[model samples]
Target: MPQSINCRVGCPESEAPNTETRAWSESRKMEAMPSRCLFLLFLSTCKLSPEVVAEVQESSDGPGAQEPMRLTDVQAAMEFIAAAEVAVIGFFQDSEVPAVSLIHSVVQNFQDVSFGISTASEVLAHYNITGNTISLFRLVDNKQLDLKGEDFESMDATKLSRFIESNNLRLVTEYNAITAIGLFNSMIPIHLLLIMNKASSEFEENLHRFQEAAKLFPGRILFILVDSGVKQNEKAISFFKLKMAELPALAIYQTLDDKWDTLPITEVLVEQVQNFCDGFLKGKGLRQNNEAKEKTSKVEL
Candidate 1:
Protein backbone atom coordinates (compact mmCIF):
# COMPACT_ATOMS: atom_id res chain seq x y z
CA MET A 1 0.00 0.00 0.00
CA PRO A 2 1.13 3.59 -0.78
CA GLN A 3 0.85 6.62 1.42
CA SER A 4 -2.27 8.70 0.86
CA ILE A 5 -2.07 12.32 -0.30
CA ASN A 6 -4.67 14.92 0.52
CA CYS A 7 -5.17 18.09 -1.51
CA ARG A 8 -7.36 21.10 -0.98
CA VAL A 9 -8.18 24.12 -3.12
CA GLY A 10 -5.32 26.17 -4.70
CA CYS A 11 -3.03 23.10 -4.84
CA PRO A 12 -0.94 21.79 -7.82
CA GLU A 13 -0.21 18.74 -10.04
CA SER A 14 2.91 17.28 -11.76
CA GLU A 15 4.12 15.74 -15.07
CA ALA A 16 4.93 12.14 -16.05
CA PRO A 17 8.33 10.45 -16.32
CA ASN A 18 9.79 9.07 -19.51
CA THR A 19 10.58 5.37 -19.22
CA GLU A 20 13.24 5.71 -21.93
CA THR A 21 15.62 7.41 -19.50
CA ARG A 22 17.06 4.54 -17.45
CA ALA A 23 20.71 5.41 -17.71
CA TRP A 24 20.74 7.73 -14.66
CA SER A 25 19.97 7.25 -10.98
CA GLU A 26 18.14 9.42 -8.40
CA SER A 27 19.76 12.53 -6.87
CA ARG A 28 18.67 14.12 -3.54
CA LYS A 29 21.38 16.67 -2.77
CA MET A 30 19.94 20.06 -1.82
CA GLU A 31 21.64 23.41 -2.48
CA ALA A 32 19.97 26.80 -2.49
CA MET A 33 20.70 29.82 -4.76
CA PRO A 34 19.25 32.18 -7.38
CA SER A 35 20.59 33.80 -10.58
CA ARG A 36 20.05 33.67 -14.35
CA CYS A 37 19.54 30.39 -16.30
CA LEU A 38 21.77 29.44 -19.27
CA PHE A 39 22.22 26.19 -21.21
CA LEU A 40 21.17 24.98 -24.66
CA LEU A 41 20.53 21.76 -26.65
CA PHE A 42 19.57 21.21 -30.23
CA LEU A 43 17.18 18.39 -31.09
CA SER A 44 15.46 17.58 -34.37
CA THR A 45 11.70 17.89 -34.21
CA CYS A 46 11.55 15.12 -36.81
CA LYS A 47 13.09 12.74 -34.28
CA LEU A 48 9.88 12.75 -32.23
CA SER A 49 7.27 10.11 -32.97
CA PRO A 50 3.91 11.22 -34.38
CA GLU A 51 2.13 10.93 -31.01
CA VAL A 52 4.93 12.68 -29.20
CA VAL A 53 4.88 15.47 -31.76
CA ALA A 54 1.15 15.80 -31.32
CA GLU A 55 1.52 16.07 -27.54
CA VAL A 56 4.08 18.85 -27.91
CA GLN A 57 1.82 20.64 -30.34
CA GLU A 58 -1.19 20.35 -28.07
CA SER A 59 0.81 21.66 -25.11
CA SER A 60 2.11 24.57 -27.21
CA ASP A 61 -1.40 25.29 -28.43
CA GLY A 62 -2.49 25.65 -24.79
CA PRO A 63 -4.85 22.71 -24.53
CA GLY A 64 -4.97 22.99 -20.73
CA ALA A 65 -3.50 26.50 -20.72
CA GLN A 66 -3.61 27.77 -17.13
CA GLU A 67 -4.92 24.72 -15.34
CA PRO A 68 -2.91 21.59 -14.55
CA MET A 69 -3.57 18.57 -16.73
CA ARG A 70 -5.12 15.57 -14.95
CA LEU A 71 -3.36 12.23 -15.17
CA THR A 72 -5.99 9.51 -15.13
CA ASP A 73 -3.55 6.61 -15.18
CA VAL A 74 0.12 5.63 -15.11
CA GLN A 75 0.44 5.33 -18.91
CA ALA A 76 -1.00 8.80 -19.38
CA ALA A 77 1.48 10.20 -16.86
CA MET A 78 4.41 8.48 -18.59
CA GLU A 79 3.50 9.84 -22.03
CA PHE A 80 3.01 13.37 -20.66
CA ILE A 81 6.46 13.59 -19.08
CA ALA A 82 8.21 11.72 -21.90
CA ALA A 83 7.13 14.44 -24.35
CA ALA A 84 7.79 17.44 -22.09
CA GLU A 85 11.08 19.33 -21.65
CA VAL A 86 10.18 20.31 -18.05
CA ALA A 87 7.36 18.79 -16.09
CA VAL A 88 6.05 18.62 -12.48
CA ILE A 89 3.67 15.99 -11.23
CA GLY A 90 1.72 16.21 -7.96
CA PHE A 91 0.90 12.87 -6.44
CA PHE A 92 -1.87 13.31 -3.95
CA GLN A 93 -4.85 11.39 -2.60
CA ASP A 94 -6.83 14.40 -1.41
CA SER A 95 -7.77 17.46 -3.46
CA GLU A 96 -8.43 19.60 -0.41
CA VAL A 97 -4.85 19.87 0.78
CA PRO A 98 -3.26 23.31 1.11
CA ALA A 99 0.05 22.38 -0.52
CA VAL A 100 -1.80 21.34 -3.61
CA SER A 101 -3.48 24.74 -3.71
CA LEU A 102 -0.17 26.53 -3.29
CA ILE A 103 1.42 24.61 -6.14
CA HIS A 104 -1.59 25.30 -8.31
CA SER A 105 -1.02 29.00 -7.81
CA VAL A 106 2.64 28.67 -8.71
CA VAL A 107 1.71 26.71 -11.84
CA GLN A 108 -0.33 29.63 -13.20
CA ASN A 109 2.73 31.87 -12.93
CA PHE A 110 5.15 29.45 -14.66
CA GLN A 111 3.60 28.93 -18.07
CA ASP A 112 6.80 27.37 -19.31
CA VAL A 113 6.51 24.21 -17.13
CA SER A 114 4.00 21.47 -17.67
CA PHE A 115 1.99 20.57 -14.51
CA GLY A 116 -0.09 17.45 -14.02
CA ILE A 117 -1.81 15.71 -11.10
CA SER A 118 -2.32 12.02 -10.31
CA THR A 119 -4.51 10.58 -7.58
CA ALA A 120 -4.25 7.09 -8.99
CA SER A 121 -2.96 4.54 -6.49
CA GLU A 122 -0.61 2.97 -9.00
CA VAL A 123 0.73 6.31 -10.20
CA LEU A 124 1.80 7.38 -6.71
CA ALA A 125 3.45 4.01 -5.99
CA HIS A 126 5.20 4.01 -9.36
CA TYR A 127 7.08 7.18 -8.43
CA ASN A 128 7.56 5.90 -4.85
CA ILE A 129 6.05 9.10 -3.58
CA THR A 130 4.66 8.62 -0.10
CA GLY A 131 2.24 11.24 1.16
CA ASN A 132 1.75 14.30 -1.04
CA THR A 133 4.81 15.21 -3.08
CA ILE A 134 5.77 17.29 -6.09
CA SER A 135 8.12 15.40 -8.40
CA LEU A 136 9.90 17.59 -10.95
CA PHE A 137 11.24 15.82 -14.03
CA ARG A 138 13.63 17.36 -16.53
CA LEU A 139 14.69 16.01 -19.92
CA VAL A 140 18.14 17.57 -19.64
CA ASP A 141 19.51 14.94 -17.27
CA ASN A 142 16.64 12.53 -17.01
CA LYS A 143 16.49 13.50 -13.32
CA GLN A 144 13.48 13.37 -11.02
CA LEU A 145 13.39 15.76 -8.03
CA ASP A 146 11.27 15.41 -4.96
CA LEU A 147 10.82 19.04 -3.93
CA LYS A 148 10.60 18.40 -0.19
CA GLY A 149 8.92 16.39 2.49
CA GLU A 150 7.00 16.92 5.84
CA ASP A 151 6.79 20.73 5.67
CA PHE A 152 5.90 21.11 1.99
CA GLU A 153 2.43 22.42 2.77
CA SER A 154 3.84 25.22 4.90
CA MET A 155 5.95 26.79 2.16
CA ASP A 156 4.79 30.27 1.14
CA ALA A 157 4.27 31.30 -2.44
CA THR A 158 7.61 33.12 -2.74
CA LYS A 159 9.70 30.29 -1.27
CA LEU A 160 7.89 27.69 -3.31
CA SER A 161 8.44 29.66 -6.51
CA ARG A 162 12.12 30.19 -5.79
CA PHE A 163 12.66 26.54 -4.84
CA ILE A 164 11.16 25.47 -8.14
CA GLU A 165 13.13 28.05 -10.12
CA SER A 166 16.52 27.30 -8.60
CA ASN A 167 16.22 23.53 -8.92
CA ASN A 168 14.68 23.83 -12.40
CA LEU A 169 18.09 23.21 -13.96
CA ARG A 170 19.50 19.83 -15.17
CA LEU A 171 22.81 18.52 -16.58
CA VAL A 172 22.14 19.57 -20.21
CA THR A 173 19.02 21.68 -20.29
CA GLU A 174 17.52 22.28 -23.72
CA TYR A 175 16.91 25.79 -25.09
CA ASN A 176 13.27 26.71 -25.67
CA ALA A 177 10.50 29.11 -24.58
CA ILE A 178 9.41 27.30 -21.37
CA THR A 179 12.86 26.11 -20.41
CA ALA A 180 14.37 29.55 -20.91
CA ILE A 181 12.62 30.83 -17.78
CA GLY A 182 14.29 28.19 -15.59
CA LEU A 183 17.65 28.66 -17.31
CA PHE A 184 17.77 32.38 -16.58
CA ASN A 185 16.46 32.20 -13.02
CA SER A 186 18.93 29.59 -11.82
CA MET A 187 21.38 30.76 -9.19
CA ILE A 188 24.32 29.53 -11.24
CA PRO A 189 25.85 32.62 -12.86
CA ILE A 190 27.99 30.82 -15.44
CA HIS A 191 26.77 28.80 -18.45
CA LEU A 192 28.20 26.39 -20.99
CA LEU A 193 26.15 26.06 -24.16
CA LEU A 194 26.70 23.00 -26.37
CA ILE A 195 25.50 24.20 -29.74
CA MET A 196 24.90 21.38 -32.19
CA ASN A 197 22.88 20.63 -35.31
CA LYS A 198 20.88 17.46 -34.62
CA ALA A 199 20.65 16.69 -38.29
CA SER A 200 24.43 16.44 -38.53
CA SER A 201 25.97 12.98 -38.44
CA GLU A 202 28.09 13.94 -35.45
CA PHE A 203 25.23 15.04 -33.20
CA GLU A 204 24.58 11.80 -31.27
CA GLU A 205 28.22 11.07 -30.52
CA ASN A 206 28.91 14.57 -29.22
CA LEU A 207 25.72 14.63 -27.17
CA HIS A 208 26.54 11.43 -25.30
CA ARG A 209 30.12 12.38 -24.54
CA PHE A 210 29.20 15.93 -23.54
CA GLN A 211 26.55 14.70 -21.13
CA GLU A 212 29.20 12.84 -19.15
CA ALA A 213 31.26 16.03 -19.05
CA ALA A 214 28.26 18.01 -17.82
CA LYS A 215 27.86 15.63 -14.88
CA LEU A 216 31.30 16.69 -13.66
CA PHE A 217 30.09 20.16 -12.57
CA PRO A 218 26.69 20.31 -10.91
CA GLY A 219 26.42 23.61 -8.98
CA ARG A 220 29.48 25.25 -10.51
CA ILE A 221 28.29 25.51 -14.11
CA LEU A 222 25.14 25.29 -16.19
CA PHE A 223 25.29 23.11 -19.31
CA ILE A 224 22.91 23.70 -22.20
CA LEU A 225 22.24 22.12 -25.59
CA VAL A 226 21.27 24.12 -28.65
CA ASP A 227 20.52 22.93 -32.15
CA SER A 228 21.42 25.34 -34.94
CA GLY A 229 18.81 23.84 -37.23
CA VAL A 230 15.91 24.83 -34.98
CA LYS A 231 14.47 28.13 -36.25
CA GLN A 232 13.28 29.31 -32.85
CA ASN A 233 16.73 28.61 -31.35
CA GLU A 234 18.36 30.89 -33.92
CA LYS A 235 18.17 33.75 -31.45
CA ALA A 236 20.44 31.96 -28.96
CA ILE A 237 22.73 30.62 -31.69
CA SER A 238 23.14 34.04 -33.30
CA PHE A 239 23.43 35.79 -29.94
CA PHE A 240 26.40 33.56 -29.27
CA LYS A 241 27.57 34.35 -32.83
CA LEU A 242 27.35 30.62 -33.64
CA LYS A 243 26.76 29.82 -37.28
CA MET A 244 25.91 26.39 -38.64
CA ALA A 245 29.36 26.17 -40.18
CA GLU A 246 30.97 26.81 -36.80
CA LEU A 247 29.00 24.13 -34.92
CA PRO A 248 28.70 21.68 -33.20
CA ALA A 249 30.36 24.05 -30.76
CA LEU A 250 30.69 24.71 -27.05
CA ALA A 251 30.47 28.19 -25.55
CA ILE A 252 30.68 29.51 -21.99
CA TYR A 253 28.74 32.54 -20.80
CA GLN A 254 28.90 34.43 -17.51
CA THR A 255 25.59 36.10 -16.67
CA LEU A 256 26.73 38.54 -13.98
CA ASP A 257 28.97 40.46 -16.38
CA ASP A 258 27.55 39.27 -19.71
CA LYS A 259 30.82 37.80 -21.03
CA TRP A 260 31.11 34.73 -23.29
CA ASP A 261 33.53 32.39 -25.08
CA THR A 262 32.78 30.12 -28.03
CA LEU A 263 34.86 27.27 -29.40
CA PRO A 264 34.23 25.00 -32.35
CA ILE A 265 35.37 21.48 -31.60
CA THR A 266 35.67 18.60 -34.08
CA GLU A 267 35.95 16.01 -31.30
CA VAL A 268 33.64 15.92 -28.27
CA LEU A 269 35.41 13.42 -26.05
CA VAL A 270 34.54 13.68 -22.35
CA GLU A 271 38.09 14.78 -21.66
CA GLN A 272 37.89 17.63 -24.17
CA VAL A 273 34.58 18.85 -22.80
CA GLN A 274 35.93 18.46 -19.27
CA ASN A 275 38.98 20.51 -20.26
CA PHE A 276 36.73 23.21 -21.68
CA CYS A 277 34.75 23.40 -18.45
CA ASP A 278 37.95 23.26 -16.40
CA GLY A 279 39.57 26.05 -18.41
CA PHE A 280 36.67 28.45 -17.82
CA LEU A 281 36.58 27.60 -14.11
CA LYS A 282 40.33 28.29 -13.86
CA GLY A 283 39.88 31.78 -15.50
CA LYS A 284 41.56 30.65 -18.74
CA GLY A 285 38.57 31.18 -21.01
CA LEU A 286 38.86 34.18 -23.33
CA ARG A 287 35.44 35.57 -22.41
CA GLN A 288 34.28 38.55 -24.44
CA ASN A 289 31.48 41.08 -23.98
CA ASN A 290 28.62 41.79 -26.37
CA GLU A 291 25.16 43.42 -26.42
CA ALA A 292 23.69 40.39 -24.68
CA LYS A 293 20.63 42.14 -23.22
CA GLU A 294 19.59 43.76 -26.47
CA LYS A 295 20.30 40.67 -28.57
CA THR A 296 18.81 38.05 -26.22
CA SER A 297 15.57 39.99 -25.74
CA LYS A 298 13.66 37.58 -27.92
CA VAL A 299 14.45 34.72 -25.53
CA GLU A 300 11.88 35.97 -23.04
CA LEU A 301 9.39 33.72 -24.82
Candidate 2:
Protein backbone atom coordinates (compact mmCIF):
# COMPACT_ATOMS: atom_id res chain seq x y z
CA MET A 1 0.00 0.00 0.00
CA PRO A 2 1.22 3.55 -0.81
CA GLN A 3 0.79 6.66 1.29
CA SER A 4 -1.33 9.55 0.07
CA ILE A 5 -0.35 13.27 0.26
CA ASN A 6 -2.31 16.51 0.07
CA CYS A 7 -2.38 18.45 -3.18
CA ARG A 8 -1.32 22.08 -3.73
CA VAL A 9 -2.54 24.56 -1.09
CA GLY A 10 -3.78 21.68 1.08
CA CYS A 11 -6.45 20.81 -1.45
CA PRO A 12 -8.97 18.02 -0.67
CA GLU A 13 -7.64 15.74 -3.45
CA SER A 14 -5.27 13.01 -2.20
CA GLU A 15 -2.83 11.23 -4.52
CA ALA A 16 -0.91 7.96 -4.16
CA PRO A 17 2.71 7.32 -5.28
CA ASN A 18 1.41 4.14 -7.06
CA THR A 19 3.78 1.43 -8.44
CA GLU A 20 6.93 3.66 -8.44
CA THR A 21 6.52 4.43 -4.72
CA ARG A 22 8.52 1.34 -3.58
CA ALA A 23 11.89 2.82 -4.57
CA TRP A 24 11.17 5.82 -2.35
CA SER A 25 10.62 3.64 0.75
CA GLU A 26 14.11 4.27 2.16
CA SER A 27 14.10 7.83 0.80
CA ARG A 28 10.99 8.58 2.87
CA LYS A 29 12.96 7.74 6.04
CA MET A 30 15.99 9.74 4.84
CA GLU A 31 14.20 13.03 5.76
CA ALA A 32 16.08 15.15 3.20
CA MET A 33 16.04 13.66 -0.27
CA PRO A 34 18.13 14.73 -3.25
CA SER A 35 16.43 17.75 -4.84
CA ARG A 36 16.61 16.31 -8.35
CA CYS A 37 15.07 12.97 -7.43
CA LEU A 38 12.58 14.71 -5.21
CA PHE A 39 11.60 16.84 -8.19
CA LEU A 40 11.03 13.78 -10.32
CA LEU A 41 8.92 12.26 -7.59
CA PHE A 42 6.95 15.48 -7.31
CA LEU A 43 6.29 15.54 -11.05
CA SER A 44 5.25 11.89 -11.14
CA THR A 45 3.01 12.11 -8.09
CA CYS A 46 1.36 15.31 -9.32
CA LYS A 47 1.04 14.03 -12.91
CA LEU A 48 2.90 17.08 -14.15
CA SER A 49 5.77 17.68 -16.60
CA PRO A 50 8.62 20.19 -16.96
CA GLU A 51 6.61 22.31 -19.38
CA VAL A 52 3.71 22.52 -16.90
CA VAL A 53 6.06 23.32 -13.99
CA ALA A 54 7.81 26.00 -16.04
CA GLU A 55 4.60 27.91 -16.57
CA VAL A 56 4.45 28.69 -12.83
CA GLN A 57 6.20 31.97 -13.46
CA GLU A 58 4.08 33.65 -16.10
CA SER A 59 4.92 37.35 -15.74
CA SER A 60 6.91 39.74 -13.57
CA ASP A 61 3.57 41.24 -12.45
CA GLY A 62 2.07 37.82 -11.69
CA PRO A 63 1.28 36.49 -8.22
CA GLY A 64 4.27 34.12 -8.23
CA ALA A 65 6.63 37.04 -8.83
CA GLN A 66 5.41 38.81 -5.68
CA GLU A 67 5.63 35.75 -3.44
CA PRO A 68 7.72 32.93 -4.85
CA MET A 69 6.72 29.43 -3.83
CA ARG A 70 9.09 27.36 -1.70
CA LEU A 71 11.66 25.62 -3.90
CA THR A 72 10.78 21.90 -3.63
CA ASP A 73 13.31 20.48 -6.12
CA VAL A 74 16.53 21.18 -8.02
CA GLN A 75 14.91 22.46 -11.21
CA ALA A 76 12.73 25.02 -9.44
CA ALA A 77 15.66 26.11 -7.27
CA MET A 78 17.89 26.59 -10.31
CA GLU A 79 15.22 28.61 -12.10
CA PHE A 80 14.64 30.77 -9.02
CA ILE A 81 18.34 31.42 -8.56
CA ALA A 82 18.74 32.41 -12.20
CA ALA A 83 15.79 34.81 -12.09
CA ALA A 84 16.68 36.42 -8.78
CA GLU A 85 20.05 38.17 -8.38
CA VAL A 86 19.63 38.24 -4.59
CA ALA A 87 17.81 35.64 -2.47
CA VAL A 88 17.10 34.38 1.03
CA ILE A 89 17.56 30.65 1.61
CA GLY A 90 16.40 28.64 4.63
CA PHE A 91 18.39 25.62 5.82
CA PHE A 92 18.26 23.40 8.88
CA GLN A 93 21.10 23.01 11.40
CA ASP A 94 22.79 19.76 12.51
CA SER A 95 21.12 19.62 15.94
CA GLU A 96 18.85 16.73 17.04
CA VAL A 97 15.84 18.86 16.19
CA PRO A 98 16.99 20.88 13.22
CA ALA A 99 16.26 24.58 13.43
CA VAL A 100 15.86 26.62 10.25
CA SER A 101 18.17 29.53 9.54
CA LEU A 102 17.36 32.07 6.84
CA ILE A 103 20.50 33.39 5.18
CA HIS A 104 20.98 35.77 2.30
CA SER A 105 23.07 34.46 -0.58
CA VAL A 106 24.23 35.96 -3.86
CA VAL A 107 23.47 33.90 -6.94
CA GLN A 108 26.80 32.51 -8.19
CA ASN A 109 25.25 29.57 -10.01
CA PHE A 110 22.47 27.01 -9.65
CA GLN A 111 24.61 24.62 -7.61
CA ASP A 112 26.04 27.17 -5.14
CA VAL A 113 22.79 28.20 -3.47
CA SER A 114 22.78 29.34 0.22
CA PHE A 115 24.44 26.44 2.04
CA GLY A 116 28.05 25.48 1.21
CA ILE A 117 27.15 23.07 -1.63
CA SER A 118 29.19 23.62 -4.81
CA THR A 119 27.98 20.80 -7.08
CA ALA A 120 25.49 21.50 -9.84
CA SER A 121 21.87 20.35 -9.45
CA GLU A 122 22.48 17.35 -11.69
CA VAL A 123 25.38 16.27 -9.50
CA LEU A 124 23.56 17.21 -6.32
CA ALA A 125 20.62 15.03 -7.35
CA HIS A 126 22.80 11.99 -6.77
CA TYR A 127 23.46 12.96 -3.13
CA ASN A 128 21.03 13.77 -0.30
CA ILE A 129 20.54 17.39 0.86
CA THR A 130 23.06 16.57 3.66
CA GLY A 131 20.60 15.59 6.45
CA ASN A 132 18.82 18.95 6.65
CA THR A 133 15.92 20.82 5.12
CA ILE A 134 16.91 23.41 2.50
CA SER A 135 14.53 25.80 0.80
CA LEU A 136 14.98 28.88 -1.45
CA PHE A 137 12.91 32.06 -1.26
CA ARG A 138 12.83 34.55 -4.15
CA LEU A 139 13.72 38.21 -3.69
CA VAL A 140 11.62 40.63 -5.69
CA ASP A 141 11.30 43.75 -3.55
CA ASN A 142 14.03 46.14 -2.39
CA LYS A 143 15.68 45.18 0.88
CA GLN A 144 18.40 46.73 3.00
CA LEU A 145 21.67 44.82 3.07
CA ASP A 146 23.96 44.47 6.07
CA LEU A 147 27.07 46.35 4.95
CA LYS A 148 29.18 45.25 7.93
CA GLY A 149 32.25 43.28 6.96
CA GLU A 150 31.24 40.25 8.99
CA ASP A 151 27.98 39.80 7.14
CA PHE A 152 28.32 37.07 4.49
CA GLU A 153 26.18 38.98 2.01
CA SER A 154 28.70 41.82 1.68
CA MET A 155 30.91 41.60 -1.43
CA ASP A 156 34.39 43.04 -2.00
CA ALA A 157 36.98 43.13 -4.74
CA THR A 158 38.15 39.60 -3.90
CA LYS A 159 34.60 38.27 -4.23
CA LEU A 160 34.17 40.22 -7.48
CA SER A 161 37.30 38.44 -8.83
CA ARG A 162 35.23 35.27 -9.40
CA PHE A 163 32.92 37.20 -11.72
CA ILE A 164 35.90 38.58 -13.66
CA GLU A 165 37.56 35.16 -13.88
CA SER A 166 34.46 33.72 -15.57
CA ASN A 167 35.14 36.08 -18.48
CA ASN A 168 37.90 35.12 -21.00
CA LEU A 169 39.74 38.43 -20.51
CA ARG A 170 43.11 38.34 -18.77
CA LEU A 171 43.39 40.60 -15.74
CA VAL A 172 46.84 42.20 -15.94
CA THR A 173 48.50 42.99 -12.65
CA GLU A 174 52.06 43.95 -11.65
CA TYR A 175 53.26 40.33 -11.58
CA ASN A 176 51.30 39.20 -14.65
CA ALA A 177 54.09 40.17 -17.08
CA ILE A 178 54.72 36.53 -17.94
CA THR A 179 51.02 35.83 -18.39
CA ALA A 180 50.69 38.89 -20.60
CA ILE A 181 53.69 37.72 -22.64
CA GLY A 182 52.15 34.27 -23.07
CA LEU A 183 48.89 35.82 -24.26
CA PHE A 184 50.77 38.05 -26.68
CA ASN A 185 52.47 34.97 -28.06
CA SER A 186 49.30 32.90 -28.47
CA MET A 187 48.68 31.07 -31.77
CA ILE A 188 46.23 33.75 -32.94
CA PRO A 189 48.63 36.54 -31.83
CA ILE A 190 46.65 38.74 -29.41
CA HIS A 191 46.19 42.46 -29.99
CA LEU A 192 46.50 43.67 -26.40
CA LEU A 193 44.74 46.84 -25.27
CA LEU A 194 44.71 48.21 -21.75
CA ILE A 195 41.84 50.00 -20.04
CA MET A 196 43.71 51.88 -17.31
CA ASN A 197 40.89 52.45 -14.79
CA LYS A 198 37.54 50.65 -14.75
CA ALA A 199 36.19 52.06 -11.50
CA SER A 200 34.82 55.15 -13.20
CA SER A 201 31.19 54.70 -14.33
CA GLU A 202 31.83 56.13 -17.79
CA PHE A 203 34.92 53.99 -18.31
CA GLU A 204 33.19 50.84 -17.03
CA GLU A 205 30.17 51.36 -19.31
CA ASN A 206 32.39 52.09 -22.31
CA LEU A 207 34.58 49.07 -21.57
CA HIS A 208 31.50 46.84 -21.34
CA ARG A 209 30.27 48.16 -24.66
CA PHE A 210 33.72 47.67 -26.20
CA GLN A 211 33.87 44.09 -24.90
CA GLU A 212 30.45 43.39 -26.46
CA ALA A 213 31.72 44.73 -29.78
CA ALA A 214 34.94 42.72 -29.54
CA LYS A 215 33.03 39.45 -29.00
CA LEU A 216 32.67 39.17 -32.80
CA PHE A 217 36.45 38.72 -33.16
CA PRO A 218 36.55 36.02 -30.42
CA GLY A 219 40.11 34.59 -29.85
CA ARG A 220 41.89 37.25 -31.92
CA ILE A 221 41.68 40.40 -29.74
CA LEU A 222 42.18 40.64 -25.97
CA PHE A 223 41.83 43.54 -23.53
CA ILE A 224 43.56 43.84 -20.14
CA LEU A 225 42.59 46.28 -17.43
CA VAL A 226 45.30 47.69 -15.19
CA ASP A 227 45.07 50.09 -12.29
CA SER A 228 48.57 51.57 -12.62
CA GLY A 229 48.13 53.58 -9.40
CA VAL A 230 49.08 50.43 -7.46
CA LYS A 231 52.69 50.67 -6.29
CA GLN A 232 53.66 47.18 -7.50
CA ASN A 233 52.65 47.94 -11.13
CA GLU A 234 55.51 50.43 -11.41
CA LYS A 235 57.48 47.98 -13.54
CA ALA A 236 54.62 47.55 -16.03
CA ILE A 237 54.13 51.32 -16.20
CA SER A 238 57.86 51.94 -16.70
CA PHE A 239 58.19 49.12 -19.28
CA PHE A 240 55.39 50.61 -21.37
CA LYS A 241 56.73 54.18 -20.84
CA LEU A 242 53.34 55.14 -19.33
CA LYS A 243 53.07 58.40 -17.40
CA MET A 244 51.36 58.20 -14.00
CA ALA A 245 50.26 61.82 -14.47
CA GLU A 246 47.81 60.54 -17.10
CA LEU A 247 46.39 57.46 -15.34
CA PRO A 248 43.28 56.87 -17.47
CA ALA A 249 44.93 56.13 -20.80
CA LEU A 250 44.36 53.45 -23.45
CA ALA A 251 47.45 51.73 -24.76
CA ILE A 252 47.50 49.12 -27.53
CA TYR A 253 50.62 46.96 -27.81
CA GLN A 254 51.40 44.46 -30.57
CA THR A 255 54.67 42.64 -29.89
CA LEU A 256 54.53 40.97 -33.34
CA ASP A 257 55.07 44.31 -35.09
CA ASP A 258 56.96 45.84 -32.15
CA LYS A 259 54.57 48.76 -32.23
CA TRP A 260 52.99 50.74 -29.33
CA ASP A 261 50.08 53.11 -29.86
CA THR A 262 48.79 55.10 -26.89
CA LEU A 263 45.85 57.46 -26.52
CA PRO A 264 44.38 59.44 -23.61
CA ILE A 265 40.77 58.31 -23.27
CA THR A 266 39.39 61.65 -22.02
CA GLU A 267 35.89 60.78 -23.22
CA VAL A 268 34.40 57.31 -22.76
CA LEU A 269 31.92 56.53 -25.52
CA VAL A 270 31.00 53.41 -27.51
CA GLU A 271 31.03 55.05 -30.94
CA GLN A 272 34.44 56.64 -30.28
CA VAL A 273 35.96 53.34 -29.10
CA GLN A 274 34.45 51.36 -32.01
CA ASN A 275 35.86 53.88 -34.49
CA PHE A 276 39.33 53.78 -32.92
CA CYS A 277 39.47 49.96 -32.84
CA ASP A 278 38.10 49.72 -36.38
CA GLY A 279 40.71 52.18 -37.64
CA PHE A 280 43.50 50.36 -35.82
CA LEU A 281 42.47 46.95 -37.17
CA LYS A 282 42.22 48.32 -40.72
CA GLY A 283 45.68 50.01 -40.46
CA LYS A 284 44.05 53.35 -41.10
CA GLY A 285 44.77 55.49 -38.00
CA LEU A 286 47.63 54.81 -35.56
CA ARG A 287 49.60 57.36 -33.55
CA GLN A 288 53.28 57.47 -34.52
CA ASN A 289 55.78 56.22 -31.95
CA ASN A 290 56.34 59.82 -30.81
CA GLU A 291 52.81 60.99 -31.47
CA ALA A 292 51.13 59.02 -28.58
CA LYS A 293 51.81 61.64 -25.92
CA GLU A 294 50.65 61.87 -22.28
CA LYS A 295 48.21 64.49 -21.02
CA THR A 296 46.44 65.41 -17.74
CA SER A 297 42.77 64.56 -17.31
CA LYS A 298 39.98 65.37 -14.78
CA VAL A 299 38.45 61.82 -14.85
CA GLU A 300 39.65 60.72 -11.38
CA LEU A 301 38.96 57.23 -10.12
**Pairs in steric clash, model 2:** none
9 Cα displacement, candidate 2 (Å): 57
Model 1 residue 99 lDDT score: 67
Model 1 deviation from the true structure expressed as Cα RMSD, one decimal place: 12.7
lDDT of 2 by residue, 76-124 (tens): 5444444432333332323232122122222222221222222244323
lDDT of 1 by residue, 1-301 (tens): 1122222212221211111221001000011122112233322222446664465446445655466777877767777776776677777878777767777788766666777888888888787877777777765544465655644666677766755564465567776544454555445667788888888887888888888887777566778887677776665666566557677788887766556777787768888878877887777855454454344322122
Find the 10 residues in a row with the least total lDDT in model 2. Answer: 35-44
Task: State which candidate has the highest lDDT.
Answer: 1
Question: What lDDT does each candidate get?
Answer: 0.61, 0.35
**TM-score for every candidate vs. truth?**
0.49, 0.37
Which regions of candidate 2 deviate over 4 angstroms? 1-182, 198-203, 285-301
Clashes of 1: 36
The total of clashing pairs for model 2 equals 0
Q: What's the distance in Å from true for residue 10, model 2?
A: 62
